[model samples]
Target: MSRRNHTDKNASGDPRKRTGAPGVSAENGDGGYNAGIAVFSYIVGGIIVWSLIGWGLDYLWGTRWIVLVGALLGAAGGFYLSHMHGLTSSRNPAGGSGAASGPSEDGNSNAK
Candidate 1:
Protein backbone atom coordinates (compact mmCIF):
# COMPACT_ATOMS: atom_id res chain seq x y z
CA MET A 1 0.00 0.00 0.00
CA SER A 2 3.07 2.24 -0.25
CA ARG A 3 4.27 4.22 -3.23
CA ARG A 4 7.47 3.08 -4.92
CA ASN A 5 9.97 5.51 -6.36
CA HIS A 6 10.81 4.20 -9.80
CA THR A 7 13.58 6.74 -10.15
CA ASP A 8 15.36 5.26 -7.16
CA LYS A 9 16.63 1.72 -6.71
CA ASN A 10 13.86 -0.83 -7.08
CA ALA A 11 12.70 -3.46 -4.60
CA SER A 12 14.95 -6.04 -6.22
CA GLY A 13 17.87 -3.94 -5.02
CA ASP A 14 19.64 -4.35 -8.36
CA PRO A 15 21.90 -1.38 -9.09
CA ARG A 16 21.18 -1.59 -12.80
CA LYS A 17 17.43 -1.33 -12.49
CA ARG A 18 14.97 -1.57 -15.37
CA THR A 19 11.28 -0.84 -15.88
CA GLY A 20 8.20 -2.55 -17.33
CA ALA A 21 9.53 -3.21 -20.82
CA PRO A 22 12.72 -4.98 -21.78
CA GLY A 23 15.65 -2.71 -22.70
CA VAL A 24 13.66 0.32 -21.48
CA SER A 25 14.88 2.40 -18.57
CA ALA A 26 13.37 5.59 -17.31
CA GLU A 27 16.58 6.35 -15.48
CA ASN A 28 18.45 5.94 -18.73
CA GLY A 29 16.42 8.79 -20.35
CA ASP A 30 15.41 6.82 -23.42
CA GLY A 31 12.40 7.82 -25.53
CA GLY A 32 10.97 4.29 -25.43
CA TYR A 33 8.41 5.32 -22.86
CA ASN A 34 7.16 8.22 -24.96
CA ALA A 35 6.95 5.99 -28.01
CA GLY A 36 4.87 3.44 -26.10
CA ILE A 37 2.42 6.13 -25.04
CA ALA A 38 2.11 7.51 -28.55
CA VAL A 39 1.30 4.07 -29.93
CA PHE A 40 -1.35 3.54 -27.33
CA SER A 41 -2.89 6.94 -28.06
CA TYR A 42 -3.08 6.15 -31.76
CA ILE A 43 -5.07 2.98 -31.14
CA VAL A 44 -7.41 4.33 -28.47
CA GLY A 45 -7.90 7.75 -30.02
CA GLY A 46 -8.84 6.23 -33.36
CA ILE A 47 -11.47 4.01 -31.78
CA ILE A 48 -13.00 6.74 -29.66
CA VAL A 49 -13.11 9.39 -32.37
CA TRP A 50 -14.46 7.08 -35.03
CA SER A 51 -17.01 5.55 -32.71
CA LEU A 52 -18.40 8.96 -31.87
CA ILE A 53 -18.62 9.83 -35.53
CA GLY A 54 -20.41 6.58 -36.19
CA TRP A 55 -22.86 7.29 -33.40
CA GLY A 56 -23.65 10.69 -34.84
CA LEU A 57 -24.24 9.24 -38.29
CA ASP A 58 -26.44 6.51 -36.89
CA TYR A 59 -28.52 9.04 -34.99
CA LEU A 60 -28.92 11.46 -37.86
CA TRP A 61 -29.80 8.85 -40.47
CA GLY A 62 -31.72 6.44 -38.25
CA THR A 63 -29.31 3.56 -38.95
CA ARG A 64 -27.93 0.95 -36.59
CA TRP A 65 -25.03 -0.63 -38.52
CA ILE A 66 -22.74 2.24 -39.45
CA VAL A 67 -21.30 2.15 -35.96
CA LEU A 68 -19.90 -1.30 -36.54
CA VAL A 69 -18.38 -0.24 -39.85
CA GLY A 70 -16.80 2.83 -38.28
CA ALA A 71 -15.43 0.81 -35.40
CA LEU A 72 -13.85 -1.71 -37.75
CA LEU A 73 -12.39 1.04 -39.90
CA GLY A 74 -10.96 2.76 -36.83
CA ALA A 75 -9.40 -0.46 -35.58
CA ALA A 76 -7.80 -1.16 -38.92
CA GLY A 77 -6.49 2.40 -39.14
CA GLY A 78 -5.20 2.25 -35.61
CA PHE A 79 -3.41 -1.02 -36.16
CA TYR A 80 -1.87 0.28 -39.34
CA LEU A 81 -0.63 3.36 -37.52
CA SER A 82 0.63 1.36 -34.55
CA HIS A 83 2.47 -1.05 -36.79
CA MET A 84 4.01 1.78 -38.77
CA HIS A 85 5.23 3.64 -35.68
CA GLY A 86 5.47 1.28 -32.71
CA LEU A 87 7.10 -1.73 -34.41
CA THR A 88 10.83 -1.19 -34.82
CA SER A 89 11.14 -3.45 -37.83
CA SER A 90 8.59 -1.34 -39.67
CA ARG A 91 10.22 1.93 -38.71
CA ASN A 92 13.83 1.20 -39.58
CA PRO A 93 13.59 -1.99 -41.66
CA ALA A 94 17.33 -2.35 -42.08
CA GLY A 95 16.65 -5.91 -43.23
CA GLY A 96 15.63 -4.63 -46.68
CA SER A 97 12.02 -5.64 -46.23
CA GLY A 98 10.57 -2.13 -46.33
CA ALA A 99 9.53 0.29 -48.99
CA ALA A 100 11.58 3.41 -49.91
CA SER A 101 14.72 1.31 -49.41
CA GLY A 102 14.98 0.74 -53.09
CA PRO A 103 16.80 3.17 -55.35
CA SER A 104 14.79 6.18 -56.26
CA GLU A 105 15.23 9.15 -58.55
CA ASP A 106 17.33 10.81 -55.88
CA GLY A 107 19.46 7.63 -55.74
CA ASN A 108 18.56 7.22 -52.13
CA SER A 109 18.95 3.64 -50.98
CA ASN A 110 19.49 1.63 -47.85
CA ALA A 111 23.11 1.06 -48.68
CA LYS A 112 24.06 0.20 -45.19
Candidate 2:
Protein backbone atom coordinates (compact mmCIF):
# COMPACT_ATOMS: atom_id res chain seq x y z
CA MET A 1 0.00 0.00 0.00
CA SER A 2 1.16 3.55 -0.78
CA ARG A 3 0.81 6.47 1.64
CA ARG A 4 0.47 10.19 0.97
CA ASN A 5 1.94 13.10 2.88
CA HIS A 6 -0.48 15.88 3.62
CA THR A 7 0.56 19.54 3.89
CA ASP A 8 -1.01 22.76 5.08
CA LYS A 9 -2.75 24.73 2.37
CA ASN A 10 -4.60 27.95 1.93
CA ALA A 11 -8.08 28.34 0.48
CA SER A 12 -6.57 28.46 -2.99
CA GLY A 13 -5.04 24.98 -2.51
CA ASP A 14 -1.46 26.41 -2.47
CA PRO A 15 0.84 25.16 0.27
CA ARG A 16 0.91 27.54 3.20
CA LYS A 17 4.19 29.38 3.68
CA ARG A 18 5.60 30.83 6.91
CA THR A 19 6.77 34.07 5.36
CA GLY A 20 7.08 36.91 7.91
CA ALA A 21 3.84 38.69 8.72
CA PRO A 22 0.84 39.63 6.61
CA GLY A 23 1.12 43.42 6.16
CA VAL A 24 4.67 44.14 7.32
CA SER A 25 6.98 44.53 4.34
CA ALA A 26 10.61 43.47 4.67
CA GLU A 27 11.95 46.53 2.86
CA ASN A 28 14.24 48.95 4.74
CA GLY A 29 14.90 46.37 7.44
CA ASP A 30 18.57 47.30 7.37
CA GLY A 31 18.13 50.30 9.72
CA GLY A 32 18.70 52.88 7.00
CA TYR A 33 15.53 54.80 7.80
CA ASN A 34 16.35 55.10 11.48
CA ALA A 35 19.87 56.13 10.72
CA GLY A 36 18.68 58.84 8.39
CA ILE A 37 16.33 60.22 11.00
CA ALA A 38 19.03 60.17 13.65
CA VAL A 39 21.48 61.94 11.42
CA PHE A 40 18.92 64.56 10.49
CA SER A 41 18.01 65.18 14.12
CA TYR A 42 21.66 65.55 15.02
CA ILE A 43 22.18 68.16 12.33
CA VAL A 44 19.08 70.15 13.22
CA GLY A 45 19.60 69.99 16.95
CA GLY A 46 23.24 70.96 16.63
CA ILE A 47 22.37 73.92 14.47
CA ILE A 48 19.61 75.17 16.74
CA VAL A 49 21.57 74.86 19.98
CA TRP A 50 24.88 76.16 18.70
CA SER A 51 23.27 78.96 16.71
CA LEU A 52 21.47 80.15 19.80
CA ILE A 53 24.70 80.25 21.70
CA GLY A 54 26.34 82.16 18.90
CA TRP A 55 23.46 84.59 18.70
CA GLY A 56 23.79 85.22 22.42
CA LEU A 57 27.49 85.92 22.04
CA ASP A 58 26.79 88.24 19.15
CA TYR A 59 24.25 90.12 21.24
CA LEU A 60 26.82 90.57 24.00
CA TRP A 61 29.97 91.18 21.91
CA GLY A 62 28.19 93.07 19.07
CA THR A 63 29.65 90.90 16.28
CA ARG A 64 27.89 89.02 13.42
CA TRP A 65 30.73 86.85 12.11
CA ILE A 66 30.80 84.80 15.31
CA VAL A 67 27.31 83.47 14.50
CA LEU A 68 28.53 82.15 11.14
CA VAL A 69 31.49 80.49 12.75
CA GLY A 70 29.24 78.88 15.34
CA ALA A 71 26.87 77.57 12.69
CA LEU A 72 29.76 76.08 10.72
CA LEU A 73 31.20 74.48 13.81
CA GLY A 74 27.82 73.00 14.70
CA ALA A 75 27.42 71.52 11.22
CA ALA A 76 30.89 69.99 11.30
CA GLY A 77 30.35 68.54 14.75
CA GLY A 78 26.97 67.13 13.79
CA PHE A 79 28.35 65.41 10.70
CA TYR A 80 31.26 64.00 12.63
CA LEU A 81 28.95 62.64 15.33
CA SER A 82 26.71 61.08 12.71
CA HIS A 83 29.68 59.42 11.04
CA MET A 84 30.86 57.99 14.34
CA HIS A 85 27.41 56.64 15.04
CA GLY A 86 27.39 54.91 11.66
CA LEU A 87 30.74 53.30 12.39
CA THR A 88 29.59 52.00 15.77
CA SER A 89 26.32 50.63 14.42
CA SER A 90 28.10 48.99 11.50
CA ARG A 91 30.53 47.35 13.88
CA ASN A 92 27.60 45.79 15.75
CA PRO A 93 25.02 44.79 13.22
CA ALA A 94 22.76 43.54 15.98
CA GLY A 95 22.92 47.02 17.57
CA GLY A 96 25.00 46.16 20.58
CA SER A 97 24.05 43.57 23.17
CA GLY A 98 24.26 46.12 25.98
CA ALA A 99 21.64 48.47 27.42
CA ALA A 100 20.10 51.65 25.89
CA SER A 101 18.39 49.56 23.22
CA GLY A 102 14.82 48.54 22.31
CA PRO A 103 12.15 51.24 21.99
CA SER A 104 13.52 54.79 22.01
CA GLU A 105 12.39 57.66 24.18
CA ASP A 106 9.60 58.31 21.68
CA GLY A 107 8.29 54.77 22.15
CA ASN A 108 9.15 53.69 18.63
CA SER A 109 10.59 50.26 18.06
CA ASN A 110 14.36 50.47 17.71
CA ALA A 111 14.30 47.33 15.62
CA LYS A 112 12.78 49.41 12.86
**Candidate 1: residue 59 Cα off by (Å):** 0.7
After superposition, candidate 2 runs with Cα above 4 Å error = 1-29, 87-112
Q: Where is the poorest 10-residue window by lDDT in model 2? A: 18-27
TM-score of 2: 0.51
- Backbone clashes per model, in order? 0, 0
Error of 2 at 34 (Å): 0.6
* Per-residue accuracy of model 1 over 3-112 as CA lDDT, tens digit each: 76656564576646543333334443333666577566767878888888999999999999888888888877877876654332233325555567545775546455
Best by TM-score: 2
lDDT of 2 at 45: 77
lDDT of 2 by residue, 18-89 (tens): 222222233333345566676777778788888888999999999988788888888877788777655214
TM match of model 1 to true structure: 0.47
**Runs off by more than 4 Å, candidate 1:** 1-31, 86-112
TM-score on alpha carbons, each prediction: 0.47, 0.51
